[model samples]
Target: MKIIVLTSWLILSVSIAFSNAYMPLKDTELESIASQFPPLEYLNPLDDGGLLQPFLIVRIPGTENSTKVQNHVNDFFIKQISQGQNSSSSEIPMWKVTHDSFQDSTPIGDNITFTNICVSRDPELAINEGDKARTRKRLTLAAHYDSKLYPEGFIGAIDSAVPCAILMYVAKVIDKALTRKQAFLNENGVGNENNQLGLQILFLDGEEAFHEWTSTDSIYGARHLAARMENEDIENVDGLIGSGLSSIDTFVLLDLLGAANPRIPSYFSETHDLYNSMRSIQKRGRNIKGLFQHKRRESNFFSSPSVSENVHFLGGTLGDDHTPFWQRGVPVLHLIPNKFPPQWHHLTDDVDHLDLRTVHDWAIIIAAFTAEYLELTNFILDQ
Candidate 1:
């Protein structure tokens, strides 16, 4: 009994000592990052007959385009991985990067490929190159890469392309924060507990059903991946450092973003704090110029809102990508527009339906909340 108590106390002390380790990224840096975007190069793609088409149709699992997009995102993650591994501590690319891949035949009748791109310092962490140290406390940013079906080609710019791109951009902005944290730990000779801060950006395949939205059709990738995690005994619910428990502290799913009118509500009671954090970040972003010009809605059940004509609050989950993880008891924060645009799941859900400013605000707010949750701020409490 005494030994257990002593161990617990020691762990607490170490945690507090490293509590101040995380560093907050500045809004100015975020603005600079946002400014570099309009990176349309990633958007336009070859349709057919040697012509480029804006529409991205249902990239079904195991198909050429599906693999191409997966490899693209995986390669995007690897660029930073190479930078970090090749460079010294001073040059530890803005973000520590690595990834994991899951492939299997799903209940939906097709073999699927799911790739989870990570920005982290977990020592079993493998870049596209190889593995590193084991992972620790994690915060994940998730979105599906596959666009839904439409009569005409479907780009799904708002359906999810913007959200996926936003995660990539957020990962880019977060690189600085991760490196800054690493730099501090190195200079102070603080044990690399900050390595526990994990950032996972998942570009899930097969989010759109091959036929229709059904238990057997939709989320082919997520269902397989979640089951596999459980099978491997990787998920840890009450541990500070382990495989899956440390692999993901919270899973945040972003979908249907970058539309003109946006309304995100606190979907799950358990994830309310994280949801509120996004809201807090939203309010904070008001000072950041060129961010969130459109009026946004918030759902605070506890307090009465200012009865303006504009009101935003969601009562329950939207049954998007977070469904599988949420059911498995993984903490989930769903960031989806409550009032989905009329173009949702339609051929018209293309760039013409997207707002760059909305994209910027979504990226920044999510980045801010993620920074806060990871304790990446220099402001350590008086523990």
Candidate 2:
């Protein structure tokens, strides 16, 4: 009897330990709080029903501005793709764009330029909202915006465009919900409110630098952005560093997210932080009596590479845009689907081949994580 009792106690202790290691999703009550976006159902052949439309640009000037830029970039893609446009490419290009504004002398000096490129709904959404004014924690969502260079008739849909759209949608949902939550609290005479977090959506250029994957071919923009963010010391605000505990907060990179019944790889230790954040959102959604709740299972759908944890490219590696950020030690949660999508790099990656449900789920997960992180940090909520 004593042995059985001790064994039961040990099991209970183990369960609790594991539970403490991670947060749980809310009470299985995910409700839809988003507006019915028409683009979600669009099917025009002109631009793959709008998937090829380019939209959004987010700048993380310093660590303080990272999160907002990340979220903004995330939301921008979500809205663009949800409204019917096929996501063409999702990359955060960090480059130097220099133009000589003269006819006499060579352009003054070479300027390092970082322009995020992703096909979107329209240019209007790309515009930056006026400065929020406070020192903020920053995070980046990097993806390529250009579709594969398949035959001219091919849409190259799965190559990357779909993932970009999903990121944009998630950002919008989180931002919109926060805005509404504050309003609701105000309406109910609640005394206090939290500030909003920022997210930058970096749509990269030259990801498929060459036709195939070579050391020098892919990750053109990512390399530039990573170098710049690490090398530059633009601000004097000491408070911003403290916001992230004097470390880079997070850089969630999205890739092959449009495949049907996708499976995310449980490949990195850093991903647990992100998973915990998502669970927090699920909980908050339930606690606040909101629409968001247990819509996803937190466990990763796939396993990490069998060969080497440090080596990103291995026997069964799926090389997407997550490499550069990981190289910089910025904790990247790369969201790649089960396997490379079949329509990838092909002409058939059109509206018909895409899966709307997968896109929707992908957007939700991103939103959940953002909301949870903002809440847990108490940075946005401390307002």
Best by TM-score: 1
Clashes of each: 13, 60
lDDT of 2 at 313: 26
Task: Compose the digit string of candidate 2's lDDT tens values, residues 65-123.
Answer: 32333344444344432343222332211111121111111122223222444322111
RMSD of 1: 10.1
Per-residue accuracy of model 1 over 288-344 as CA lDDT, tens digit each: 675544443442211222421123433222456766676666767777755677777
Best by lDDT: 1
> Which lDDT values do the candidates have, in the order given?
0.55, 0.42
lDDT of 2 at 319: 47
Compared with the true structure, model 1 gives a TM-score of 0.72
**Which parts of model 1 are misplaced by more than 4 Å?**
1-58, 80-133, 191-195, 234-246, 290-317, 378-383
Q: Weakest 10 consecutive residues, lDDT, candidate 2?
A: 11-20
